[model samples]
Target chain A: MVTMRDVAREAGVSKATVSYVVSGSSLISEKTAAKVRAAMEKLGYSVNHTARALSTAKTNAIGVVTSFRNNGACFDLSAGAYLYGIAAAARRHGYDTMLLTGDDGVEAIRSAALSRRVDGVVVLDVLIGDARVGALKESGIPAVMLGSPADSQGVDVVDSNFEAAAVSLVERLYDHGHRSILFIGWPEAVYERKLNYAVRFRASLMEACAMRGLRVGAVYAHDATLGASEVIPRALRDCPSATAMVIHNDAAVVGAPQAFERTGIRVPADLSVVTVMPDQLGEGMQIPFDSVGIDVDAVASHTVDRLVERIGDPEMSARVELLDQPMHVRGSVRAAHED
Target chain B: MVTMRDVAREAGVSKATVSYVVSGSSLISEKTAAKVRAAMEKLGYSVNHTARALSTAKTNAIGVVTSFRNNGACFDLSAGAYLYGIAAAARRHGYDTMLLTGDDGVEAIRSAALSRRVDGVVVLDVLIGDARVGALKESGIPAVMLGSPADSQGVDVVDSNFEAAAVSLVERLYDHGHRSILFIGWPEAVYERKLNYAVRFRASLMEACAMRGLRVGAVYAHDATLGASEVIPRALRDCPSATAMVIHNDAAVVGAPQAFERTGIRVPADLSVVTVMPDQLGEGMQIPFDSVGIDVDAVASHTVDRLVERIGDPEMSARVELLDQPMHVRGSVRAAHED
Candidate 1:
């Protein structure tokens, strides 16, 4: 029931100053803005967002499209981290986030675009041949992607350098004198769905090992049902000469220490181990390990920054940015002994 | 820039008919609505949500507030499942979800209410004496909570029956002829924060055990750093005669089988184990266990349904609803041996 005029009168400011503050204009000074905000708070003046948006042609909100479906089937833990990042960054920029979490991703994106409820969009869980890419482009809405899709010609994308992560993992082990190493990968379904990160990591890891002339041993999709104790021994049996291991699965890494205890393989004594996962997951483990952590927050921050920049400057060029991953050493590796 | 008039002309219908379809009013028949939609699609007519909202005072969107903060410190995985459920249910009701993931819970709700960017709100990860509850009441917004706060009067709340779950766990273990039991609870931080579910479950479990005259042994807060293997062994040492275990920690449960293997304690042979967790988690494990599964989606659906109903009918009475949890039998329990 309260109006901006009442707030301006209460604060001893002009109506235009109150308007500038409500519209989030940069023209207002911090002191003046604070005064106006305090006045608005005292007067309990709730903004009519619809009317303000109609005049300014801005919603002060962004759409975040993810693949957390209706059937409760697909939930990517790592993607959720990125989502958390965007929301926080958006809040910092004085914007809200509108989320689209249905399974019909393309349709959802199109509908969000058509309605113009948000100023921009952030896409997550991008696939190799993602249909949402075309829909986003067709909508002509400013957008950013968390995953680097197969063909991202005119879209802004920010992701962890999975290739660099793979190279770093292999080189860390190779430098430790590990020639024959066992590799543990994500589940088969991850590759089948063509999730960009999973596909990129596996391919780049194989290539990196090949380039160094390191013999890569058996690779198995981590089955959560079968804990690491069951899979690690099987992988070792396939590569009896393996003196180290590299893991890319989050669930499997949780049981790696137990697996080592059961197999009588001492860490850094008989075999070295390294895992590539989110830093939170890596650090949250009871027994930490040498790991290459994907800074998911960094990627999300970059995506949001670029999108906000593009929203302000419509003519800005699209870019693909990949951040370097940090490797934490916990003394899980040692120099191998020659027989 | 195609207008409703243009679409109506193409579809051979009145402008009012097209307006009804765009407003999502139930006055129009499905056949006529389909025709109008097809015409609008062919003409590339995108709705201007702000203008329409200004006219109708309806945004057709709901707000979801969660504590997935910017620092990347607090992400509750179980709460994420409930969020997924709300998004799906909102879409089914022809609504979109706006996410507020900032840590400033009270301010976020107040701002969201003042902005009027969403028609309703869904609050997740509620605490015992949540400040957001007061903010919601002050804003006079139609909102629902996923957790039952200590003072949830005049607000709609949907949650899993943690008390019933506790009773069921104790009775099942008691029926198996187990006289002594070891309980592994959530971290001390959970109780310190007074998360309603954790506090309620612990109290209910203790009471249920006392009622049946069961000797509950050493209760340890699950330490993820030490793992279940270390904690379980230590818990057993305190209660050497314990013949059963009840685990309420997600991270600790992941290492239970390995813990049993290390201590040479066979499940259902020397000890029986029961877990209280999300159904998805219990079902996702390669080796499933007997558990009390919280149907997160059912709770979310009910929350959304109640919120949407209240949004339509402002005078609807506030109610607290608790859905029964499903008990899964996976043969993890056995008859106790008598000396």
Candidate 2:
């Protein structure tokens, strides 16, 4: 149990010299190094593996910071794919991924960077004016966010084009002769937290509504299943003339058809639905949803690739990349009748 | 840039001494420390943040290694809860969680341990005879596995009671007067890989079936949805009189009833189905299967707790814990009759 201190004392040298000689990290004269080596032999001291790793190369690990709020206290289906994608991409880059879930947010991110546990950070579920972006920038650690904020001051971001999808969905319904539509958005907490995607999509929705002179009512829900209970009844009460709907919540997608069935409102016959979701839910319904895909894997790969590039060149200019949003307008929409 | 070497040279001290004086990782005589400090003032050498971190207390970070396989390189609904559970527990204990997904399983694990990136590791989706167990043991790093392996030589393990669930399920089917039953298991690759849960569950199923003198046939499929296609036709074609089925595949669970409906088979009228899954799927189905619950949160908490305890005492003998297996017998099973 000889400590490095004992070795230093035996060698009659400073502790840093002993470390330098053992790690081969710093330039030391052969004579001084020989003395440190001999002292180590005499004391039978072993270097900690951490010191050994630093001598050869970096940890070769990356940090991925996923929002604790995204999954709440338990699991959420949405965030899982993005995290898995990032890990797979990191592995391909010969780096292990470490998921950092710190409830304290920016401070926790600062700790991970300062500790040198990871080379760079990938922040998921990015919000506007995120404190972690500022923290990562100030620390000079390379970072990438999965969503882009309105202000791209110091952070690299990658996101899906939710704005385009929103505008197009609204416009497409308008062209199909639907004037009255109801928009089912995420819970108020999403926009209240000022997440980039939620805010941007809502803005785009409003822009389209204004341009087309369409009458639209918006509502929010937290749970998809229970959300439908509120969405259906409220849709009828608030926008009774509505003939089309643009839905954003996945929970609502899974529950809305079932809810409509119980309420005696059939898809296309009473109301048409367009949504952003995976194809599995869309294909399973009695009437499939006209849907836009969420390319989580593409988002993960782009974010990781950018972070790796930034890690190699810490001084590189930060950039934002948004993947194209593609829509699959299955037979969920129909020509609307005059109300 | 002025380096620690410059500080050491000016102070006429070894590099380790400068690091010791700056990081304060080790004690030095006040006179020697003062000399190094004066050299730092003369050379204007600033300590890097990494060195600054080691000067403080622990990093307060724990590494959780999840097999990218669990999520299937993207997203799998199954791995979500386990990961979410681990993150929640780590937060409660004031430990930041780092997810490690290594394509090279043992080497990646060894890398994490040797680099000193984490205080401890929580490995998920553990396999029997896993090389990581021996590697972690030899390295003397505190580690825990979500599933116990066949050999518990050095590492601690915590898992859901899959074996108990399997045995109980088979025995219950027998109690319901099911003499001839068909057993549908996970893909053969799961067993071929020697995963502890799959191997143990199948073994327990066999043991229970043997004791009851019931005739059972087993089949395996990779995809759960398509698995129903193969399983349904194969079961009745092979066993012919299999009045009950024990299903363990999630995809099969989601798809089997739909398959049954298309084939015009009524549940409990034509065939009985018993499964081990979350209640949500069963309750939402056309016919709810007799179900057994998987307590992923409990397993995650147990795994994290042990890793934390081991981090506090690396010398503690390793242990394995299995949480309870709870079952809900919906009306999916009925008394078997001689046709």
Lowest-sum lDDT 10-residue window in model 1 chain B = B68-77
Cα lDDT of model 2 by residue, B242-315, tens digit: 88998876556655654565556778888888888644333323226777877666767878888889899977
| Candidate that would win on DockQ | 1
- Give the least accurate 10-residue stretch of model 1 chain A, judged by summed lDDT: A68-77
RMSD of each: 3.5, 8.2
Candidate 2 per-residue C-alpha lDDT over A1-339 given as tens digits, one digit per residue, 9 for 90 to 100: 465788899989998899888779889999999999999889767754344334443556687786654432222445666777888888788776766775666866776675566788888767777777778777667788888887767688888888888888997899889998898877677777887887888898889898999988888755433356557767777888899998887656655654565566777888888988644333323226788877767778888999899889988888888777788877788989975
Compared with the true structure, model 2 gives a TM-score of: 0.71
Off by over 4 Å in 1: A5-18, A21-42, A68-75, A222-229, A261-265, B1-17, B21-39, B68-75, B218-226
Candidate with the greatest TM-score versus the true structure: 1
lDDT of 1 at A308: 93
The estimated TM-scores of all candidates read: 0.91, 0.71
